[model samples]
Target: MLGSLFQKFKDGLRKNTPTFQKFFGKVGGLFAAKLDAATIDELEEALFAADFGVETTEEILGEIRAAYRNNKDLRGQDAAKIGATVLSRVLEGAEGQFSPNPEHHPEVIALIGVNGAGKTTTAAKLAWRLQQEGQKVILGACDTFRAAANAQINTWAERLNVEIVSSQHGADSAAVAYDTLQAAKSRGYNVAILDTAGRLHTKGHLLEELKKLGRVVQKLDTSAPHHRWLVVDGSLGSNSIEQARVFHESFGLTGLVITKLDGTSRGGALVGIYRSLKLPVYFVGLGEKPEDLQPFSTTAYVEALFG
Candidate 1:
């Protein structure tokens, strides 16, 4: 399963890989040759160009420098091996598995992100994925603020053949969330995925509204809203890290769904976002299809990155 998924991820990431591979190719000669300051500077620039955030890039460079000092005979591939090891270690703390607790009937997952982050589509895809696993799923169109947010979610519900609870335009979003959960409990759905309005992290009022939505869910069931997942645009590069930080602070985000990895060369940005936030990535959107959203696997991701 992971092999096929990794292949798909690799295919989607092909455009980004050349940039990443360039670093290895440039420094491949250095492994057999003596390491010098110039080579290290070039490696740093390559990593930055690959979108590895400064902190993570520095950490990897430090490790390589230390290893080079210890043994000048290291081959470029060996350095690549070392780099992968260091990156895996940096990502280990953020690794986590997301599985719905069977005991928590109607497991609630609220998707949050800024406009164009693909939150609504992710919600639909997530619901479809869960449904395929034989779990009854429902969607909540709680994005009352966006003009056609409800209509978009309703369309997905029809396409996916899942039930949805939504209110009219200009309605209170918190009320929609509260009613969605109430309906989920009464209707015996296995999971309730709420699609919230896309709000910029810099918007304080909108952030407060997100908190209100969470509060309404908790009021129904303390253990409700079991997962708060932030959907981020993978193409945003280092900027995505700031977005994750702000959303995590506002909602205590439990997981992340990175979207649009197929279209950008900034796939390396995942490293920075995970390293900075320390939040597990639950899913990655590889394409527009429902089946394209694959569960996050650390081993597969690292292998694809360094392959």
Candidate 2:
């Protein structure tokens, strides 16, 4: 199972693997030749370039340097193993877990994030995945702020053969959320994935709107929205760490869904984000297919990232 998952990550990251490997300070999945001073310097530069952040980058470099000093015969692959081990340790307990509570007829998952973070698409994909897992699912289109939000979600619902609840543009998003949960409960749906409007983490008013939506959701079932996930743009590098921090502070994120990773070389940004937020990464967008949004697996991730 882990092997297949690793293959999926490799497939997802194949396009950027060249640059991705460099970001790890590796010369082709291994060091250029030997574990020497020049190689160590290159690794540090690569780690920084990949946005590993100072703490993680320093830890990885320190481990490799220590290994190199103790054993002069340490090889490039050996160093890569040490680095991957450090990364896996830092991201321990990052794999998110979720199972709908039967008492809560329709477990709610509110997808939160700023604009262009792939919230809407993730909502549809998540709904589809849950439905495939035999959980009756409904997508709540609460993103009434973006003009194209309705059209986009509606298209996904139709294409994926799933149900959706939406409102007119500029309408009260909270009201729409209420209606969606109401539909889910009445229709016997087990999961309600709400794709809320994107809010700039810096804007208090926008955050207030999200809080209102959360409050409204709880009125139906105090635990209706069981998962509050932040959908982050993985390509944003260390800036994404700040985004996660701010959203986490205001919205109280339960997990994360990193998207657009297939397009970026700075894949180390994910490690930094996790190190800073410590939030479980529930899902990661690997491709455009519905199944491409694979569940986060630390083992698979470290293997793929370093390889």
Candidate 3:
């Protein structure tokens, strides 16, 4: 299962890595062999095309150029070495903060996003991860407006063997969330993962519904819903940024969980999101399976992207 996820990551990297046309025709052989300005430009374009984004690519190229200026003797493998170094430097400190606070009582995690953003799936995956850590979890189906939403959480609950609190369809989601928190308290569950309805970010009514859910959770534990995660489909490209903006404005998102990353070529959206929101990327969904939901690690991600 995980092998396929890793393979997809590898495939994305291979497809996006420096194209043969630029690498072989323009940059000479694997050995650096003293590259000229034109060759450097080609290399830069290749990285940008690979979705490294212009700023990241230029920063990397700048580092390579600076290194070359200091040591003119640098050649084929030397160029590759410096290129990798620059990439590593650019992505060096971009690590993920995936560890949820186990000490916090009822570590409430409220997952929110637009329809088809993979919010329910991510909630289930996160709940599974928490259960694996030996924490008793309660899955809260706060998306009461959608019939399938309740069934979705129930399915995950059965599969994970965790308890869930849900209500009838078209019920007040905030009331569901409130009742769920009390249930978690009474049942002594260590965590509560609330799955809110998925609506277009432009929908004011739906967005206000999420805010109300937040207020309800806060009423119970004050720190309830400690984490408001926005699940984004990486395949949506730049639109993910706009979606995030709407959610952040409405719910004050704490972090992001990007899904379908392996299926998209515009991986630059990750960088764009970080640049635009400055929120930590908590996790990424690489595939459809539960286990395919992998914790986001910026270092390993850069390596996989350049592989």
Candidate 4:
């Protein structure tokens, strides 16, 4: 039973990762026998194509080249192992950690990002995850900027049987957050997850509105919104780095939750985002299912890509 469950977990992580697996099949050998000049070039190109970023790509290739120089017969398996080691080193300390603080009753977690980054679905998934762990979680549909946002979150709240606080379209989003936290505190809820509007991250006014939401929530618990996670679309590759930087500058984001990795060919962007901001990745959308929103695991990620 345990083995079957573990295999299913790994299969889920490998969704749409066949390109990578085919490239580095069976321990290694995208090329035959020995590491030659042409094979080395191919490896470099593959890493770059996977969106490993220039810095990381160079580092991995540099190490492999050095190894080849030492041993003219350096097999692809050895080279692949070396590349995975370098990547694992770069992604060190990138996993996020969290626990409900007893002092901060109803610790707030604000999910922020641009539209189509899967914030609403991620919000619902996270709420369900927390509840499964016995945390009294409540959803806060604080995205008053879009009417559909309110309706979508409401639907998930009903499906998950989780309580939520929301307002009409164009209502004050900060006010919704304030009320959500207040309700969580009064009713003894352990955590309140706030689903913020999909701010474009470029508009000055939109970011200012995000700042206001933060300030308003602090009035309730001072340390409310303890987890300001920026939900990013992994398919955008390094393009997401600049957007995340903008949100981080304005909102002082605490962590990241990268979504859409289940289908993105450029899943390596997670490394660039972490390298740029040094924020821990709290969760990743490995698939569309609610159960597929798994916690960030460096081991699982490197294994999936390198194997």
Instruction: Give one digit per residue, the lDDT tens place, for model 3 in 1-307.
Output: 4444656765664455545223422334434356667767777766665566667667767877887788776554555555566656654434457555767668888999888999888888888887887888888888887798889889988987778899998898999889888988888887888998986344898888888888888888887788888899887766678879988987888888888888566665677676677787888888877788887776556545543
lDDT (CA) for every model shown? 0.81, 0.82, 0.75, 0.83
RMSD of each: 2.8, 2.5, 3.6, 2.7
Q: For model 3, what is the error of residue 38's alpha carbon versus the real structure, in angstroms, after optimal superposition?
A: 4.1
Q: What is the C-alpha lDDT profile of model 1 across 104-135, one tens digit per residue?
A: 76789999999899999999999999899988
In model 1, the runs with Cα more than 4 Å from the true position are 8-14, 24-39, 200-202
Score every model by TM-score: 0.89, 0.92, 0.84, 0.92
Superior candidate under TM-score, 3 versus 4: 4
Candidate 4 structure quality by residue, lDDT tens digits, 14-112: 454554454466644453367788888878877777788998989989999999999999877777788789989999999897788888888889999
Worst lDDT 10-window in candidate 1: 25-34
* Candidate 2 CA-lDDT value: 0.82
Count of backbone clashes, every candidate in sequence? 0, 0, 5, 0
